[model samples]
Target: MSVDDGILEHMFESDFASADDKTVVAAIEECARAEAMLAARRLAATAELTARYTEPDEDRDHLAVDGWRMASAEISAAMRVGDRAASSQMCIAMALRERLPKVAALFAQGRLSAALVSTITWRTQLIVDSQIAQRIDTAIAQRAGEWGGLSVARLESAIDSLVDQHDPDARRRMREAAQNRDVRLGKRDDVTGTMSLWGRLSIADGELLKRRLAQLSSQVCKDDPRTAGQRRSEALGAIAANAEGLSCRCGSPDCPSAGQDDPRAAHFVINVITEANAPNTEPVPATPAESATAERAAGPVEPATEPQAAEPATERSKPRSAAALIIGGGLIPTPLLAELIKNGAKVQWVHKPPAAPETGYRPSGKTARFVRMRDMTCRFPGCTRPAEFCDLDHTTPSPAGATHPSNLKCLCRIHHLLKTFGGWGDQQHPDGTVLWTAPSGRTYFTHPGSRLFYPGWDTTTATLLVPTGPARHGDKGAMMPRRRRTRAQDRLRRIERERALNAIDRKRWAAPATTQPSRPPPQNDDPWKITTDANIDTTDTDPAPF
Candidate 1:
């Protein structure tokens, strides 16, 4: 039955609870088939849109980078997505249309989902030979409908094996992942004053660090209140501070490491912005019994003279207010701020930001710092690359525009290229606001990310009276920077090299065994006797003597 006929029969059946189990199952199956068909239609439409923007003659040559980038920008604006995502859609669309006709047919018949089609296209990207690609496409399409129950890894392995048998050289090369090792700090979590730490390191270095942490974590006294995990966490902090070892919290005078300073400990600075005139409460003095109990439960405490006053019930019941802000970290609660201060955290007040923009092709260091602090991330809509890693692009090209804070905005490399070459236009306002115009003539506005965190800071700069001349058009003859070797050439060379190596290895494995020369028998018929007569005939079929 047709997918539309099935849908028409059950489209009004909203009361699934009253339906029989088989009927409900049938409805679900029909809906899934309908969804797949819809996804296929969407991909076809995307492919059509891409073709509309692409120059027909340039389609054969993938070097038409600007044409595809323009299409990506239009798709991005219309779909409310990033350029990378839009480009991915276009690539999948084109792959299905031009290279995987059999798979595309299955997708159109509602036997495959968009996600499955996407995977099929990506895994087959290395196949440059049209005949080989078509054969693989046909093979995959015949069995792809049964892959819905397979895990992603298993599915990839299945596809890879098929590709390998037909064209081993067409398999995607695994990159050197170790070369990309890096450490990164995740954004602040929902809990205040906390963030996640994750990274990749060489196996040897990771093991060494683990061993060091384990050694330091075990150095504390048995009476230490913290658990092994807590001790390891503290050890990491100790390492960061250049301390020799973690401090013992046993608080006993007889503890071997008591009353000693870590000479290796180095001073570290932390920037904190706090509200002026915050309430200050003196530490309450503890009795002798209370001190002992507190020491056993936590750690040692210093004696103080003043006692803290009790707050009213209403005030105590209210939620704790944020009293300070860490420079890169999130909000700090009042109690945590007090604890930080008690732990000898230094406090410094920052002066107001500069009011005027600087003059030059490059912004002054102070102005650059101010812009980074104000934006906090790239000003391109939907882009979240941190401001520190982005290029400070002029809203108006240099020479025509000044190096003012109002004109300078952060843009990552790809978006910067888009604005420079993909016919995108943008304007900046004095209040750190950016207005972007996509190639499709759609407009999007983005405000400073800092406004969400620091609403009180004044990011406004003086507006310049620079003249924006007639819109500059891209040179018709200009092309994207060419690679040393085109993709097709590179693929051909790599495949040939790999195939040559494989042939050598196969020849080595498949070589025929050579017959050994006949040995002379012992003259005296002694099995262990050695004989050196090369002319003696010992070619009998009998087994050799022991």
Candidate 2:
């Protein structure tokens, strides 16, 4: 038997849910309206923050002592945005506050987007003349509603057209900018090993480059399954490989470059880790099972009588008859793996686990390997960041926390910061299931690898928390383990204290209009893909002024 009267009276958060579509839809709309209102409030807050740190009178306290740099840094740290992005947002917020009242009113109405306002700001900033900039902003503000439903290209083009008409020197400025054409390569970000290219080119040069890529891409055989994007990528690679001339090679079975390595070209290398249990035979699944690893998954390996450190690169350079492709921890077709192996690159095996003591605070190389293998991806509930790519967090904190499976979990950088600094909480069970409790007392749960892939081994353990009560014969408080409060816990306490200091009104922050106009679904009926120069990410060599 259980009883709670006074304790329950202090609560408002409920566990009830409605299944009716109408009720659910109404709830969703209510949440959306509240969110729109919150967005307006958030903007207002940002504007206030900016004003505190910014000054029109350069001589008076110089805009909050810490200035725009400190202000943007504080905002970015609190809100988790890039510094440049935060500065840009602050600029727009300030502009709306001082210069664009009509746009600010539209924002208060909460129909237009922050992104759209930012876009208009970008357009107006291009006009160096203050009066012309104001004129352009006024025009755009008048047509803000019409600006909705337009693609980024059309919007940009429209803004450019207005600039062209209003400012005659804009054309001359563009011609001058065109003269400073250059290109630079960015780092590879994905499994495909494609690098980001940044540059500006003259109109004629840009057109020529496009025409060549199109011509080369069109030459692909009708039987080929490669998409237009893939073909274009191949053409670009071909161009980069030998810039003076172009090659029509697709690297398929019949292609001339299928078996031959070009002396002057670079291979697109994929870092593939070989696992013990994956099937390397024909007709292998496109994605390998999560729990397929066995003792001999990487195949037969005789233990060396004398232990000698082996280099991974040296081992990879050594050829093998077969390999199970754990490329980016994703399932790659055996045929595709074989094709890649036939080329210059081969699958790389994870180094043997390091032997580390149990009580150590830090994870050893072996522990890292084991954790990566066991978790496969970040253990933060709902996060999919590869465990290999994430930081291993001591779930219970170090010194008090041990370097064991139950004590350790993977968390991506942002999520790790959020957990350590933003009042988030996590608890791990022995079976590799993580229960995450948010600041609002809401609990979420997730397991190791996807059970859809790993059939029999996964545990279906995502469940809500149940309250605990201690039965007492006399007047005694419920006993619990005393844990050292973490920074997150302190943050939680601060939030509670702040809430207690202010009068709690549930509806205060959720002010909404009587009715919100229903947004029309995008009609993608226009079949032909309409792309423009703006879509091309020619991120300039010059650092952007936020």
| lDDT tens digits by residue: candidate 1, 66-136 | 56666777776666677778889888998898889899999999998878888888887777789998899
For each candidate in turn, the TM-score is 0.63, 0.42
What lDDT score goes with residue 19 in model 2? 51
Cα lDDT tens digits, model 2, 37-149, are 56666777788987875554333222122245445545654454555667777877876776566777776776666667777666554344567656766776788878877
Residue 109 in model 2: lDDT: 76
Which candidate achieves the best lDDT against the true structure?
1
Clashes of 2: 5
Whose TM-score is greatest here?
1
Worst 10 residues of 1 by lDDT: 304-313
Error of 2 at 519 (Å): 65
